[model samples]
Target: MSRVCELTGKGPMSGNTISHANNKTRRRFLPNLNEVTLMSDALGQSFKLRISAAALRSVDHRGGLDGYLAKAKDDELSSNALKIKKEIAKAQAAA
Candidate 1:
């Protein structure tokens, strides 16, 4: 998958690196991502994703890695497990 934070919609950002010497260069800002395994209570299984540290912290604060994911909506590609995760993430932001 791409280097993106699924929950926060964070990805690589390009910018200029300014130096104290009044020089500028190219720079890239990448989100703090971690490979995490979220569980799907609905499916009684687990899945993984590369999410931002903030997202992980949010999920953890709401519950646990798997606990939160246990809540997203099930659609075409959104399996019961995925839906649970999405739901939990949404709920976290609202809170």
Candidate 2:
């Protein structure tokens, strides 16, 4: 899989590596991505996702996966995550 944060849609960013002699070299700054299994309270299921460290903190701050997904922008989510978000919404609505 590519080095991208599934939850945040964070990908490698292009930049420059400056040397002491003021030489600039092209470089890529990648997000701190990790594979984590997060639980959904609404669906009572767990899903594994590759996400950034910042996104992980946001997930916790929002109370969990369900909450974060509720507030997340649809375009930022991967297809798999979008499906889970919809399922959680459906389950919550049915409850």
Tens digits of lDDT, candidate 1, 9-34 = 66899999999997999999988989
Pick the lDDT winner.
2
User: In model 1, which range of ten residues has the least summed lDDT?
Assistant: 72-81
Q: Report the number of the highest-TM-score candidate.
A: 2
Q: Model 1, which residues run further than 4 Å from truth?
A: 65-95
Task: Give the alpha carbon lDDT tens digit for every residue of 1-95 in model 2.
Answer: 99889999999999999999999999999999999999999888899999999999999999999999999999999999999999999999999
Q: Give the TM-scores of the predictions, in the order they appear.
A: 0.62, 0.98
